[model samples]
Target: MHFPVSGVDVFPLIPPAVAFAVSSVTACAGTSGAFLLLPFMVSVLGFTSPAVSPTNFIYNIVAIPGGLARYIREGRMAWPLTWVIILGTLPGVFAGAWIRICYLSDLKAFKLFVGLVLLYLGIRLLYESAGRYLKTREQTIALEKKFQERMRKIKSKTSTHLAAGIPAEAVVKNRLVSLRKIEYDFWGETFSFNTITIFILALVVGLVGGIYGIGGGTIIAPFCVSILGLPVYTVAGAALAGTFLTSIAGVVFYVVLAFTPLGMHNAFSPDWFLGVLFGFGGFWGTYCGACMQKFLPERLIRGVLGILVTILAASYVIQFLII
Candidate 1:
């Protein structure tokens, strides 16, 4: 089948099916799987053009909503964090998009650049996971084990107020939204974060996401847990929501760029058929992934994701040098 805009041939049920599989696994971990999709487009399907970036963003536009919706429904969504990230990232995305159009038209060069970026991001995740996360996880496990022993001894199982003397009603209150700091109660623990710091971080994440055709979730998720010391279970929803909104803006901007009278040789526009095919697959993939996330062990998830990122980053940098 022929796609009208980019003149790419479409394989009925094949691309979307593949997209669904990729998006499903990654989305659960707060990724749109665009990083994976971009390679698939270039190496596998041979959509080896700069247009692939926007096309991947198109996947974010369509495929991200399902996961975002799930986060919202669960009431785990963090609005302040999402807003800060959106505010900072929205502008950077435009700059990054422009860069893609103006300079990085050749797929080979673009791949090298992207590979390096992804490589850094992947390594950063590993560094944090190893340096800080392991200790934190051990502490939590020890606490939980002690708590379980206490519960088994007395059979007294009231809800644990991780924060001493905090009431059940207070936990329901999303009482953590500020420019200076954020303090919220979850699973009986009151957590706080620096709002200004997060805003600055979000902008950087947005810029990278925009250029890479990924939603900022990939960056924001690690930042929340590794840097801010927030629990992943708590921050996941907010990250997903923030990424979803930003991607919406990103895709619209990419589309608008295509329509605008840009002087670049390869102007920005999406391969609608390709994006839609990916989105259709991402729809189911996201749904299944979200469901699976709850059952999967936290460390296992982190390990797998970390490994994938490191491998990709190494491959990207190596390939760039070799070629």
Candidate 2:
């Protein structure tokens, strides 16, 4: 299939297939897989136009709801954090979109920026993952042992209650929401973060996400976990919700820009058909990933994401050097 806007020739099934595989894994970390998908579109599918950024945002628009729904259903959604992220990111997304359209249209420069951003994310996740294993070994071991014992007790109770057939309620509970801080309880512990700090971070992340077409969830999720000392389980929903909202703004911005003369110069309009195809696969993938996330170890998810992102970043940088 040939997409005239993107000037790429490939099988129609390819995009969704790749999207499904990527989304299923990345959704566990609160990302829509747009960071990885951007590279795939650029390098594998030859979609290097400026419009690719907005098109990727479209994928987030379509793909995120399924995962967000799961998170909300599980009562893991942090309403305060979601609102903060949305408020902070919306303005920055507009600014970032303008910058991308006006300044960073050059493919080489854009690729360099993307490579650097990915490098930063990769390193941060890896460093945090390493710290988890090294600095907190004893604590981690004790926590795991306790968790195992709890699981055993739950299983025994569940078996006994099987005849009653009552479903278990969500494990996450929102404790407090305020302008200065937000707090939530998950499992047996309470996690809190400064609202102002998150807002600031979301603003910066929105700017970067607008440029990269990732909707900011990828960066925000990791930051919430690694820096803010929040659990991945609690942060995932808010991060994805933020990404979805920002992506809607981004796509609208790109569409409006496409009507102007500037947009025509760099193909700022998304290839809607292609983006939707990718989203179709992402929908199911994201839903499944979110459903499975609670069963997986947080450290394992972070480690895998870190390694995968690092490899992709290295490849991009190496390609630039070779060129």
- Compare the candidates by TM-score and give the number of the best one: 2
Which residue pairs collide, candidate 1? Answer: 20-281, 24-285, 162-188
lDDT, candidate 1, at 31:
75
After superposition, the stretches of candidate 2 with alpha carbons farther than 4 Å from their true spots are 131-147, 150-170
- TM-score versus the correct structure, for each prediction: 0.85, 0.91
Regions of model 1 farther than 4 Å from truth: 128-132, 137-173
- Model 2 pairs whose backbones collide: none
| lDDT tens digits by residue: candidate 2, 57-134 | 889989889999999888878788889999989988988888887888877878888888899889877876785553
What would the TM-score be for candidate 2 when compared with the true structure? 0.91
> What are the Cα lDDT values of the candidates?
0.69, 0.82
What tens-digit string does per-residue lDDT give for candidate 1 at 187-260? 55666788888888887878787777776667788777666666555566667666677777777887777776
| Model 1, position 103: C-alpha lDDT score | 72
Error of 2 at 276 (Å): 0.4
Q: Model 1 scores what on Cα lDDT?
A: 0.69
